[model samples]
Target: SPTTANLLLPRLATDRAAMAASASAPPHSLLLAAVALAALASVAAARDENGVYDPCSDTRIQRGDGFSFGIAFATLGAFYSGGSVQLSPCDRRLSLASSGQLAVFRPKVDEISLLTINTTTGFNPATAGGYMVAFAGRKYAARSVPTFVSNSSYTVSSFTLVLEFNKGRLQNLHWKKDGCGACAKSSSLVCIGKQTCAFRTQSCKSQGPVDCSIGIQLAFSGTDKHESVLNSWYEVSNLRQYSLYGLYSNLKDTLSGQFNKFF
Candidate 1:
């Protein structure tokens, strides 16, 4: 009864808060658009995207699967952006760099971690899914390392970071040695060291002096007998370089076009 009470209470509270939040915030499609446009929008919401009913305050996310989840901002860097729900799962644990107050999580949920992000990828809060720095020192940062979300539990794992980056340049970096989909259908990827590995990779691959950028991505996690999808739209606001600008715009346009064409 206590366990059920604990779960139910949060749901009730969240339901009320979500109702209040929705009454104040924009409509669901616009909110979704805000989440999608985060790559480009300078201002966005601070609430966790995965906490409420994604479509609106009324749509409740089905939790209680014994999963741990939360969102973190770069404790050390620039402001965070975006306003949509991108659900990512991790092997639970967090550090200062990855530290944001735990906004949305199920209590006593097992080893869902928060460290592996920077280990395999860099931190870009505007994007959806890299591990926000929970801990950072002069040299290294910790992130959501996998194992918790894998086949060890119900015999499945989905520490899915379904994001897009420069394909041409990413291949150049030595991005190896991180948890990967152990199955044949899964692909392998590694996080680069903090030197903007994607930047180096993207820049070198280009013919002329150009800059490229990566936008709002979602790092999501959940476990079920079925699969879930998180759709993102990015509108570019600022870029690191001209090369970065072109890359962001191109990816945004193409992805937006493709998403609109089908849906």
Candidate 2:
């Protein structure tokens, strides 16, 4: 089998060499033919002694030629910034119970919308809240992060979703529909900085002084009742470190619309 697979490599290598030689203006047809041949070769190589190919074989090679998964189009400042933060379990279901809620990040979406449910009346999208999208900046010092801390840890353990803006600034978002309207509407929304802040990381320290003329930080309590919880984060970097295909197998069906444009 190894010898058989090796025998097919010469043609692919020759095609690649030819393409590189004519990189300036290779014929489109040639490119398509090469791609098709490569796919066929991979399928053939991934077959077993029984001549049956494993459709989902890990040995198969599929180049991610034209795919674009980049988010965070723009950075807040000159430093490292702008790119979608990934979450685990991208397709979390909504809770229908009286005390149920779910948080999901739509890959390639622009806005973050939160919907609320009233136990007696049911779900209310009208009362739901939304925000212009943003990504959380690097966590500096614990005090520098903008998030709510429950005075009574017993009532609400603690939760945070911080987004960064220009000048090393940060804000916490709860990803909910209602509440937090005033903060989003205000041009000069007052926020608690070093005065009243908590760190998500245990060993939090200040990177530097970052100024944010306008930002949003919405607070919510985890202790509050919810029907079911599907809190997960997606890490885009994981795709490459591990096997590529299975990384997003679960999300392929549930993922919707253009990744950059979320409803």
Candidate 3:
């Protein structure tokens, strides 16, 4: 019945009714549910022989095409043990428990999108663990360096995640911090401890806002599978550091307003 259970994972993650049921499910069922929800976010773009989408396959992504993927947030103990780190969240050795969470985002190739994750109860990176992993297919996965999400003084709300591809395959995922430069200058934002930009929870809207949700500015870099040099999307965009905040805010508002029904 493992296969049947796996088939139910996505529903448990996205469906409110199923989610309520899962609160009382067994531990193993919860683990599969977490993995299923994370993996299913992106699998709709590709599939294997069984007509099931395997997140481990090496699929080619074309320019201008949109694809979905997941980011898993867990404690250091869940991902690292014996003084070593797990490469992929898909590994059987990894245990994704209730303490862990997943955020799914669908972004177009060569374009930047603002991705948000709603944590109704509020997420304390210091306590919940600031580690995250970005994964698509099994072969296209990367763990981010531990990012300090919040401290007693402030909570950093915005970040930039760069997906680097080489020859049409994902090579690495990088998290770039702005060192609070943009936030310090913005009249609407605040700089936290001179380390990062933050949004005050009081200033955020109850429905959805950067302060209430984790916001990631997603962008793609590197060459596609074709290995062609003519169309370098990253280079064409010419993204500057200071410009990122404006772009992130604009996209965040547009997406939140347009897709609030689903999220």
lDDT of 2 by residue, 136-255 (tens): 212221112112321211001112232222221222233221122233333322223323222221111111121111112111111111212111112212222332222222332232
CA lDDT for candidate 1: 0.23
| TM-score result, candidate 1 | 0.23
Relative to the true structure, how large is the alpha-carbon lDDT of every model? 0.23, 0.19, 0.50
* Candidate order (lDDT): 3, 1, 2
Q: Quote the RMSD, in angstroms, for model 3.
A: 9.5
The positional error of residue 45 in candidate 2, measured at the CA in angstroms, is 26
lDDT of 2 at 89: 12
Per-residue CA lDDT of model 1 for 15-119, tens digit only, reads 433223334222211101111221222222223333333111222222222212233332232122232322121222222224332222222211111111111
Q: After aligning candidate 2 to the native by TM-score, how far in Å is the CA of 48 from where it should be?
A: 26
Separately for all candidates shown, the number of backbone clashes (residues 3 or more apart, or on different chains) is 48, 24, 6
Q: What is the TM-score of each predicted model, taking all chains together? A: 0.23, 0.15, 0.64
- Model 3 lowest lDDT segment of ten: 34-43
Report the candidate with higher TM-score, 1 versus 3: 3
Against the hidden true structure, what lDDT does model 2 obtain? 0.19
